[model samples]
Target chain A: MTATAAPFRAKRVLPGFTLSLGTTLLYLVLIVLIPIAALILKGAEIGPAAFWAIVSSERAVAAFRITLTAAAIATAFNAAYGLLMAWVLVRHDFPGKRILDALMDVPFALPTAVAGLSLTALFSANGWFGQVLHPAGIPVVYTIWGIALAMAFTSIPFVVRTVQPVLEDLDPSLEQAAETLGATPWQVFTRVVFPAILPAWLAGCTTAFARSLGEFGAIVFIAGNLPFETEIAALLAYIRLEEYDYNGAAAIALVLLGFALVLLIVSNILQSWAARHREATR
Target chain B: MSAPDMIAPGSAATGHGRPARTMGARALIGLAVILTLLIVVAPLVYIFARAFSEGWQVYASNILDPAMLHAIWLTSLVAVIVVPLNIAFGIAAAWAVAKHRFPGRGVLVTMIEIPFSISPIIAGICYLLLYGRQGLLGPWLGEVDLQVMFALPGIVLVTMFVTAPFVAREVLPLMQAQGTAQEEAAVTLGASGWQVFRRVTLPNIRFALLYGAVLCTARAVGEFGGVSVVSGNIRGQTNTLPLHVELLFNDLNAVGAFAAASTLTVIALVALILKAVLEGRRG
Candidate 1:
């Protein structure tokens, strides 16, 4: 009995276990892990002193600042707008609802370059929105605002998609009971619903932020690419690469990659924590 | 507080704790609609508006230009090679991570998804640092007369990296939910592993696989930053459609760029429609 139990615990019942996992690991190594390892190695070769000198340079600092500010702005807008969109999609029925739902995924489907081109055109001085905005004491393209808008456009789906399912799956009975207990509509949402979706919302915002940090293709066209003003960290890294400044490129890239990896891990942790908390409540 | 008025059991269920009709509700709906129009639909409409602003003949000629044709061909070629390879990787990763209880399964799943978080530009930088002329394998690649960077192979490799997780992300959850019971039952009845997978698992996950494939195809066709890093933006040799759009725009050929962009926009619209349909089917 002991020998049988021990063997069962140690062994997998499924066939092709090794084959499938081996293939997965091999592909992951060749395509994903090895390249990342090379980047890290390149960063290491730059050494801590030179790396600091590169990353802390004035232009690098300004790029990081602009990227962070724009991403923060984008994430903040999505946090509010995304919750509203999710709430509308899940709780309400209206004409064009299906179209609206499908349009939420356009950012994911649209190429970033096209998105940038379209956005820049739309907000340029003589362009559609630009014609309106430029005279109204507002301008969008070729500024930090343009960068944020592009970031927002590209990352809107992250927040909405994350929160939509959680909102949909929320039990209506909880809200019903809260209403029966004399909670107002606002109170019911704040007390009962918001708590339920908060973790997922936070996770979504984190991913959106990380995505905005790394957003390049959609931003450059509209960003004006001014050193220390409009240039983002990712574009700055690309510029470094173009100039054959391998150390500069690798250093900047490592920081952006580090932010992405950390944000990703944080998002994953929040998501699993949300899952576990939901299970416990159930 | 009017709680008593709202206390009707069936009524409360229908409203989900809100009034059935309220000024606030209408306003919220209106706000959502307007913002969606401004944020999502306006740019989309702008693409075609500007694309054909110069008239139909110019638009047609832009799309038919030899360079534009090559860009289209190159983009499609990359997609053709990338989507199927990613589908294979996605399935293998899903099968392993969802079905098996390996010691490092969670880490492996994370590894597979690493590309999703990292920027495409960073991904290109990684590859460049590993394979460029002065990179780790640069000497070896040069010695072998193999050019992975600034060429088709480089484009494909980076695109593959970016789109790797889509199929797995879509399929893994469904496989996990379906569980090992049916497969074990098949095994008990003397079916081989391949037979069990084909007769039992594949049928269940086919829609999910297709969903992932659609998504993979869209990303493969649309990828820009990562591919740009490696492809070196050669005029007729390696310029993909997205890069070509950038080039035309920089050349002050706004109409041509938008005309080219309209084609990609059409692809995006079709992809969105397919995704919506697939989501319904999967559900």
Candidate 2:
């Protein structure tokens, strides 16, 4: 048995397995792992005291707080609106539905800088939306709201795309049976539909939140970058780099990285939970 | 699974009764439309409006400007270089992770996806810490007179980092779904491994590969934050189109900025259209 197992392990039907896998590992290490390791090593060299000092400063703390808050707000909006959008695209047939469905990816395809510029232009005091919104005393540009708006614009695709396929794949018979049993529309949705899509919706929201947390290009353009106000952790790291404060930049970046890592882990866990729930239901 | 039948048109007569459109559903659709328009469509329109606001002659001149032309060239150059390298890496990684059962398969998949979640700004910072003047190899690199930070190579590297996972992410699932049956069959029929892959696997995954490349091109062309951090914003030197747009805007060359921006916008739109077409074909 040991001899047979050894020979089987040595045999691979496809050639170049070692070459392909070796190149893959080497490339991943060179491109992804080493650079990330460099970041952690730099942070470590700075030590905990200096790292804490940099990240715990009022400005840094404020930046973190604002980034988190804006991301939370954006994710909340996406959670509701993204669900609606997915439902509409999946359940309702409307004119221009395909066009609208394609449009959902514009933010993903468009450069973040362009999104920021266009958003800032439209929301500034003299721009189109600005003229109306500012007159109504609802200033969006150069505010945290602007930051959140940009975040929402760029990250909304995450929620929409994630929830879309799940919604499309949902068994219509389940809803039909519920309705046939004398359930109201609200009851059918809340009892049958909502439960089926909740895990994906939650996963999508978490991913959107994660993405918003790290948003830099779009936010920096419209965020006004007022240290404790509109400035985000990412911008702060850029600022530190500009000031030639490597330690400070590394420390702040490490914090942002920490947040991203936590979010990614949470997102993964939620996704697996979603997959497992789907399997159980099946 | 007949699932598509349930969602397709004529579902009303398909035994599973389609829910009648209610007032709430109408309102929901309306709200979704409005939100999408406000959040997604309006800005896209705004870019073109501003681009053409200065008339065609100005737009024409901005596009023809040597600096703008250089920026466009650099952006293409980055995409040209980065996308193929990423395609190779993606193919390699996906081939290994999807086709083989390994002990650390899950970890490898997660690691490949790490860049997707990490901020581009942080990605730039990581490269900086690795290759900057005062970086880990800074002293050694100075001896060799090599410049990796604030240069074209740096910009390309960072753009590659940000767009790394696109093709892999697109191709992996499709390959996994297809399995290795066809390749195994080809091998048993005495076809070479390369021939099996080139003839069998490639045809099956070609659309996915193209879709991935299109997305990668869109991203590499539009990448801003990571490029910004590393490119040093050297006018007519390291500045890609996006950075050039930022520079023009900062210089208050609104016409030129929007003009350059419009070019990038067109690239994005075309990429999207291609993606949609490819997706339709795949479906």
Candidate 3:
């Protein structure tokens, strides 16, 4: 191969490359990078032993346990219900289907604090649903159930939105072929359709779980902030900050951030896997 | 086999085979609908119900109260400042990453998305650690007689961080999909940089940009966790609408709290409608 001198510079067709790119880099560093760096630095200042001590303390452990447990329950419920909701929206047509579809986004749009307030009001002993459930020995407010309920409410859209598009784009002939081969409806769904959407469904659930883990405003009002019981990790971090325990707050925040980063990476991988599988099938 | 020969006659005759709705399917749909109503719609309806429970006069008076009014203004101010800056950052980031191939592009995108995964409360703590009275920059700030924590700047900064990814996330994919052919062609026709962006790029991404703006506005107006940590919840000063609702509820003024919440509920409703409309148009 004859070696020719390479051009010293690449050609760019678009203008503002430097201006736009420079602004983007500068802004991202100033806004996102610096503060997070500050948090990591603050955590470093405490050293590993002290940081570990703070995060492993009884109160911190309890907060993490409660947060994870409530988020798990909420994600479990959403996984089933969100799938059903997406299935109904895609497969069946009804008079109010449009309205029902639109309403799925309410959680995303509504303020978390308002969601917390209204949920607490509705589940209080004197409130409507609470009037029914409270007398039956079900205490929702100030309980773990309340935390789970709030988590489920705020995260319902994630699962539905993720699954709905997949369902809509699903080819119906596969299911029809299953039926023609004498498979039952449930068999067609579980064997054929579910496999196609499984990755997306799992990704959605993981994201919803991750979101629930970090939820704060909605859970706070209903949680009653009872230490060692209903207090979530996010709330505990805030409390630590309020008490001016910078190291304590940083340690707890680091743990939550770690969980979030791991879950996000997992979700991203699942999403790409789903996309690749869909392409391969096509 | 030829394409036509490969297709079975019976399969072709089936058109798009939509399953006949069975009784079980109907029942399942019905159950799902009821669950959606119970879980999603009830709390929304309850906000309005409780707001007007003490009569329209009481609701009106509660909203008209000075502290609540101040809270509304503060919330608006925060949104007004935060949304524009976020929009600028989003467009810049999206432009740089989506339009240009560069090293560390993935890293930049991930950094922008970090706030989405991290808790807002944690973000607030980051700001507190950097700018609080006893923070790293606290002494410098104290020397300058500047208050960053528990004040307006802190509130705006945290909200901006929490809502940073909205516009960029929305617009980036669309820009990537559309590619740079149009912009390049316009530039070849002697269009300037700003002209290419304004005429060629802006129109393409206008809907997505608006959608992101609406989402950013909704979040900024309703943000609680981040603002709460930084605002110190000072009544009639630092309190935003959501914080004020919390303040009222803590004061055992349930009706007043609901009334304030209803205002935010209305804003959320408007944002939802706008989003739905934009989605419909895009679809």
Per-residue CA lDDT of model 2 for A136-200, tens digit only, reads 99999889999999999888777776667667667888888999999998999999888988887
Q: B22-87, model 2: which lDDT tens digit per residue?
A: 888778778888888888988989888988898998889989999999999999999999999999
Please give, for residues B38-89, the per-residue lDDT of candidate 3 as tens digits: 9999999999999999899999999999999999899999999999999998
Best by DockQ: 2
Residue pairs clashing, model 3: none
The DockQ for candidate 3, computed on C-alphas, is 0.49
List chain B TM-scores, each candidate.
0.92, 0.92, 0.93
Chain A only: TM-score of every candidate? 0.94, 0.96, 0.96
lDDT of model 3 at residue A66? 99
lDDT of 1 by residue, B1-283 (tens): 0000001111111223233277778898899999999999999999999999989999999999999999999999999999988888888888888887756777887777788888999999999998899999999999999999999999999999998888888888799999999988899999999998899999999988988888888899999999989999999999999999999999999999999899999998887777766766666
Model 1 alpha-carbon drift over 4 Å, by segment: A1-10, A280-282, B1-20
- Over the stretch A232-266, how does candidate 1's per-residue lDDT look in tens digits? 99999999999999999999999998898788778
Clashes of each: 0, 0, 0
Q: For model 3, how does the per-residue alpha-carbon lDDT over A1-282 read when each residue is reduced to its tens digit?
A: 112312211555687767877888887777778888888998899999999999999999999999999999999999999899878877776667777877888887899999999999999999989999999999999999999999999888877877776676688888889999999999999999899889878888988999899999999999999999999999999999878888999999989988998998998888788778777655
Q: Which 10 successive residues of model 3 chain A have the least lDDT summed? A: A1-10
Q: Which candidate, 1 or 2, has the higher TM-score?
A: 2
Cα error, candidate 3, residue B131 (Å): 0.7
* Candidate number achieving the greatest lDDT relative to the actual structure: 1
Clashing pairs in 1: none
Using DockQ as the measure, name the better of candidate 1 and candidate 3: 1
